[model samples]
Target chain A: MTDRQLKIIEIVKQSGPITSEQIATLLSVTRATLRPDLAILTMSGILDARPKVGYFYVGIDENNLIAKKLRSKKVEDLMSLPVVVGEEATVYDTIVTIFLEDTGSVFVTDGGFLTGVVSRKDLLKNAIGGIDINKIPVGIIMTRRPNIVMAFPDENISDVARKIIEHEVDSVPVVEHVKREDGKEGYKILGKISKINIARFFVELAGE
Target chain B: MTDRQLKIIEIVKQSGPITSEQIATLLSVTRATLRPDLAILTMSGILDARPKVGYFYVGIDENNLIAKKLRSKKVEDLMSLPVVVGEEATVYDTIVTIFLEDTGSVFVTDGGFLTGVVSRKDLLKNAIGGIDINKIPVGIIMTRRPNIVMAFPDENISDVARKIIEHEVDSVPVVEHVKREDGKEGYKILGKISKINIARFFVELAGE
Candidate 1:
């Protein structure tokens, strides 16, 4: 945060429940300059302001605020496009897919719908055996649907982090429910969220 | 940053060349409460203060601030313990070591000195080639030193981040020169800094 932001916080702590007009008068700044600062402070939960009342100190336990921010965040806020491979792709093809993407896992899809998931460990186990990698379809060995953990765009980010850590998986496909042409329900893969994304988010937060 | 902190920045921007006493009186806050905030703002380069003049606006563009912060941060601030394995350890053993530590890379050491580094990609590549995992030592395939990018404790974090991205490696081992019992010079492994560490540090900054 900037120095001005820090000072604003200190003032609120000392004199809040205080009004923006009072704050502006004291800081010798016009409401115009304080507008953005106040908006950011309130939006970030550093200050709580009421319509008729005024701005007030939100307390310090910034870690709590950060956790709350993460909890309320949606999957779409951080999701990245999933690296996918067709279900019919061969194990050798899957190896190429893994290397090309440089990812630990890939979603197996059939016509843009998620069907299963394959990871490096699964492919490595296959490669260690004497089987013909070129002839074996990855779908035959993938973790099939109904077993895969997923998130919708609107789901909480905290829940997504839980799924990744709990499942001991590198990435989770973010899928949305859609009606098929035949009137059947199916999931359309939109993106993926990995531990790296979470870490990056945390880094961004620290900068704030 | 808190609301008061934001106010301070605004005040400095609008009235800079303003004094601490004037800031304290305007905000009705004690000098004690404002002390730490000023120090952090100055230290982070968010505000430049002159001895008799006072604090002034440093401008927006937080990316610049964050980059500066990263560039000056020491490796010790971001380091974690190195996950190590003996140089003679077999590829199969290295696989087990990778799983146990759950790290993307491991340092190959001999007699407590750095030797080489191995990553998951290396092991996966080896596993896919149908090699004798049990008999082949990982040292044979490891990225040997002079090739391995490392950081000293005092090295800048931005430099570390650059090395990792440039080398396309997941992490860098932090090392320091030391004297051996036999009065010979050697290097000592101190810790490891990975992409995750960088992310976590960023998150912490946002919270502050």
Candidate 2:
């Protein structure tokens, strides 16, 4: 901040809700002289300008600043390539895919549209239940569509992080609505956001 | 920040390496009048003061401010109660306990000291690999001690979070060094830090 800007903040802090004209008079300068400084102060969120009332002191809040910056980050900026499988793939194949990709869950698609989600937990339960892993298709035991928590490319990282926590799921597929060949609405998988992503983001935030 | 502080920053930014007396002279104020403001600016990292020279403009870095706040959090402040089981517990029983507690992994202890960690992935892998889970003790399948990633109460959250991501593990046990009956070094599990905790913390930071 400049000395003039600092002086302007001091003026506002003491007599906030004071007009720009009054501040100019107190500083022995014209309103035009204080224009740029006032602009910088208010623009930086150090002061609030109310019509007919004047600029009010809105000192920098570090917590709110952090929150604002975090919210500014969108899902598209941090999402990773989604691990996906076809609905017709066997449960055993899905499990193999999961291990190969090292993902917590895999999205199931039918004709290239999301149909279900199968997590490690789900596969474990089925694996222990005496089910024929090689015979049963993943579509038979997966958490079917409309039940899966999903994300969009433009959604805020904070919002999606909340979904991951609230849903108690390791990850969610970032999807887009599309019309299937059967003329039904379906979601096309784009990316995935998981706890790992959030953790990495936390590391990134701290490192930066 | 106060107006005088802002003014001080401006003066330093424009004519830095200029002494305090010179700044006081330019502002038509006494050195005493600028002392508190200068102190605040320097303390907040907005200015760097040299012994012989005047204050230099360090400026406020929002990213660093966020990083400092994040690093300020310690593991003990955010860790959750660890889900533990004895080494004698069968894999089937451990799996049941995991479902009952809704945890991703369970710490295995022997004589009340951490011995190993068994994650859902390990159990699932064993479950589908034709093992008799009911007869196999979790100790046989767990990632044994000395190979486990562990945390301490005083470790920084950023450092632990980095460990979680780099190690590719779901969580790590917060342990304390202890002497066993035979005088062998052992770790007593105190808590666990997981992606869930980190995600929750991310929410808390963004919310606050």
Candidate 3:
């Protein structure tokens, strides 16, 4: 739908039972053009049209609406499969996986649980000037030593995006090995969240 | 570095002045076979060598140690620039951006400030199915409402990760619209976080 159509819907929601003629006048569109919009909205389940009357808001299926609008309700729906590495991994081993997998960072784990995170920056920083990549262990260059960015798969992307951006960081590590209150880890490493993910969901959609 | 090398480093770091034969005994390699391994590690700067005593642990450096084994550091040293998206969008638009960018999600914002986030699932569920993608206002499909995943640019990635897990999210959104303490809004989206990013850093330098 075009921006005008959305605007029309918003207007209708704000002022329902509005006549097509009234809408056309407000939007500077002809009544004929308004008819097509009304039809489109009706077909798309956004509105209910009546002859010799006006358009009323079409109540969405609560289930459908919830599924669409609430990320908190379904944040893990689109997460990718999870894969992790250990902190004890050698630089060569880490490099092979990173290059082969087309990934930018790797989560370092201990006993199947997240211990820390390492990114290209970490590797490059060590490799570029002072440290040599071949012999060094991953333990010395990690950004997670004093702190770590982490995620539990059950979360929504908005919360995750806020963390990455707020800290000026990239990805987070998944710690499925940790025991939960029920003696089970809350979630697994479903996938990685990125700025790109947010952009695809919001920016691109908004543009269209 | 493979798991094999990582073990070697751990053994040395924990117990230095160890011979290649002794290292091989623990790593399932023969003393003769471990010669190349020892050579490779020593040349890489992860280990120090002596003429007759044995090989010892090289001081920890970015290149020589594993990330998880290292002391945690700030994210500023690891995170990259942020990626952002506009607030208004359609489902179709979102699909195009997501596939094009290869990012997991995008940051949702208005006038350069982050408002919230929307994921692929957010678009698929909200914009697809019965919802009119072209007309429905994306502002309504925001996930993790009210900018829950908040972060400051100067903060560390580790700090952000901890909060992400604590907040139970896949990623965090970066913002710069700071409002005075008067309950006004002042925040802009700068970037995002994901497990992939953190995971990538921990890998060895061989791959990107």
Candidate 4:
């Protein structure tokens, strides 16, 4: 909605059962110009109007509005591609890929199948342990599948945000179920939902 | 200010030169109770008033309001303790320090004098190079002084935010000038400003 429409919603919310004439006067706009805004609001269930009683508020709870917006939004609307590396890739090469992508984590995959995930913390842990990064395969140190937190396209974005907070993880891979040639069920990585993404979304949609 | 006061500001911003009678009625409060809120707005220069014309909006440029808030705020108001490690400490120990603290970077200090900064990326680079983390001092691999992005207590938080964004680093160490025992000027580490801090500040202050 445009700023003007948002303003109209605020007006009706603060003082419902107010006549269009009164609202128009308060906004310094003509009734004809406000007609469209009123219609859109009424049609969208944000407002209710009567011939004699005029406009009344019928909007969602304003206090939890941001939370509601987040919950209603699907993950697919905001998911982005995940940084990935082959399972056979050495820890040294994985480090290069991570810095090159400028991400906190990368997915370890084997023949396009989801396998494991490695994060900056994981790499730091390995580095601190006096391990040979060049010789060790990243898959050996990665958080294996079944332990990795993930999300589906149809899941609520708010749930994804909760997962990030609860797990204290940077990102969760977006995945989908796939059937292997042998008929066993497996998952395929599609995208990721990062803390940065959620933070940015909250900033953009919460207030102005 | 309370959310109610914020709402009052929004009301005046959208439809300024509006009468107190209208605002009080819309907010479902008495004009007597709104007196304090009005006074605060007028005192803050966020609103201007006239005897007959009512209240008028006289605030910062709306487009740059958020940026202005961040710029005008002191780093001291938002800083958190810097995660630190001794300069003589091994890269292996630095890795342990980083993971234990759950921070992406740590300050390398020698006798309380600001020396260098070691980040996850730095450790990863060392790891990839097949260096002996347990033997190499972090000071040897750290981003030396004059290369590290820093903030002072008097510096703008917005400037710190910009540094993080421009440099693509996780955090900036907050530092201040101090006199050494030998009478030379030196820098002392105070705290840090991170991306999460900025994001939380934005959420708390904007549009609430």
Candidate 5:
């Protein structure tokens, strides 16, 4: 904004709804000279104009700008590397992978296709259920496909965020359809969009 | 944006750097009448004006607007009710409470003062460690005070988001300093700021 434009705002703020003629008089400029500045101020929602009352200081619509920026972002830009294990892997091994990867959950794949997901809570339930975690396959305790919430690369970050909240899961696997070696079609794990990613994104959005 | 303002933008976007006189000719209005609209378009950052040249379509600075809105929010406005348990509660019972409440972790309080936090991962390790979960207190395996990351009511959500990402914790207990029954000052659990809250907030911001 120019110095004169800012001054116009100040004058309007202090003595509005004051007429443009009075403002031009204070600035020693004709109404024609101040018309453009007034137009900018009112058009940007920084001031309100009435037929007889003149201009009133009105703030910008911050939420609209925020929403616009948020909507422009896609899930692919924010997802993190997914931790994966085979469906046949023992529950003990899967837990070890979770610790090694420092992830809240691990995706389970069969023939390199996503089949299920196992979380800390699920493993804890089984671990305390007196079962032999080393003897049973992780697939036995996992939340299987068709039930697992999934995300695509082009999906909106906001939509995936809603999925994470509604499903109450720490993360959702970003997947894409592919053909396995045996010619069966299934989703292949591409990445994982988790709360950590969302938190980090939030920090970045605020920081920027 | 007004119809004339949008029409002005379209003209600038298609034929800019076109002069105000040319734009006025295209719109069938006098140059003086188009001055305010051009001023509004340029001031709001929708168009760029260059002296001795003409206007150019310059999109809004979305990040700045998003950052402003994100920074305006405080943690207290987005936090969820924290699940709390006494230090004497059994690990098994704590796990039960976690399942019942569907929370990722529970705050452990001693004499109404926060003493520790026990997460699902913590319980999972102990549950599989061959310890008697039914006989041991949850405090025995919890992350104790002074080591726990915490949040206050007035903290910026973005700062807490950084803490959550840096600490790799699903949530942090929001606390307030209070005098216990024994006259000792300690933090009292108030609520929890979790990734879910962040995710939900993100959805709302985008939705709005």
Candidate 6:
């Protein structure tokens, strides 16, 4: 979050369900500047308004609105793709690929169907106790049914943050907003956006 | 994950349910070095062990053991702390703290219970339409019931990546490993672990 936004929230809390017009006057800022903040607060589910009265704080659980909004954000906007993977040939071959690709998590797909996921830990755990890394089918050791976390293309940073909170997962996969109509290919793996990505994205956005 | 660990896995995957002594030989490393990785893999549920036969990969889709391990790594370890929130008197007041603190996220706790969270976007959303930021209580306007993400203290880089992949949230609230025994107060808030932190940390670790 930016400093200005924080300042604005302070003002609102100090006063009672005050009007935006009054706030603009008190803050000496134009309504236009304050507009974005108001929208964000409402989206966060913290703001409640009456026909004649102004907005007031709801409950502490109001963050749910923000969490819901985060889910709406597309993973594509956040994902990076053409994911690197080691080919499946033999156990030894897969072992070499794990190092060459240099990824903690690697995707294992056959004919591009999203077959499975493999991580260094997966390989290591299986390999302990003199298990064969070279001969065994990598498929046997790979994570089949890899948990797919996704993100939408157009969504707010808040929405992403909320999703992270709600799901308690680290990252969401970014699938293309629109897949091929034919459905010949599954959703292209755009990349992944995790809670960390959201954290850094905002830090950079805030110029902090 | 570390390169040494990967090497150990490769040796085992190629060798088979061999002894750790055999694994140590193939990797050209001591058994002591391999022990930690072996133990980790076995405990993570990726590798199943036999008293005499040795360990084997349980196959994929069982639950990303490594990812799950890293998922437990706390955001507090990765997150920044003394989180510095503005006086939570108004909805608008949050903006000031956001801007001044130069932080995107702020925690709100009364008597250290973590009542709510406020971000710059939260302030922006509320400040619009001449919304009075001061009058709106941040606790009321702030995000309540935020999705909680956690991490353990002994997290590796891969674990960080997995958390991002699993949770898809931007920021994780790093809390103490041991929760408060009696009440929530003992469970102190640590800094945060963000994607950026993970990325940066990995970059440094990789260099080493």
Q: Which parts of model 6 are misplaced by more than 4 Å?
A: A1-72, A86-102, A146-188, A202-207, B1-208
Best by lDDT: 2
Docking class of 4: incorrect
Give chain B TM-scores in order: 0.70, 0.72, 0.56, 0.70, 0.83, 0.50
Ranked candidates (lDDT, high to low): 2, 5, 1, 4, 3, 6
* Top DockQ hit: 5
Q: Mind giving the per-residue lDDT tens digits that candidate 1 earns over B20-129?
A: 88899899999888887776566545577999998898844444444445465788988998999998999988988877787778999888889899988788899877
TM-score of each: 0.61, 0.73, 0.36, 0.60, 0.85, 0.34
Provide the clash count, candidate 2: 6
- As for model 6, its CA RMSD to the true structure in angstroms is 29.3
Report how large a share of the reference interface contacts model 2 reproduces.
Answer: 0.73
Pitting candidate 1 against candidate 3, the one with the higher DockQ is 1
lDDT (C-alpha) at residue B149 in model 2: 94
- Scored against the true structure, residue B90 in model 2 reaches a CA lDDT of 97
- As for lDDT, the candidate ahead, 3 or 5, is 5
Candidate 5 lDDT for residue A184: 95
Better of 5 and 6 by DockQ: 5
Candidate 5 per-residue C-alpha lDDT over B1-208 given as tens digits, one digit per residue, 9 for 90 to 100: 6779878987987898999999999999999999888877888778998998999999665676688678878988999999999999999999999999999999999988999999988888888787898999998999998999999999988889889888888899999998756779999788999888888888899884
Q: How many Å off is the CA of B7 in candidate 5? A: 6.9
Clashes of 6: 133
Sorting all predicted structures by TM-score, with the top scorer first, yields 5, 2, 1, 4, 3, 6
Q: Model 3, stretches more than 4 Å misplaced?
A: A1-70, A180-190, A203-208, B1-208
Ten residues in sequence with the least summed lDDT for candidate 1 chain A: A59-68
Better of 4 and 5 by lDDT: 5
- Winner of 1 and 4 under lDDT: 1
Off by over 4 Å in 2: A1-60, A180-184, B1-59, B180-184
Query: Per-residue lDDT of B49-96 in model 2, one digit per residue for the tens?
Result: 888876798766678668978998999999999999999999999999
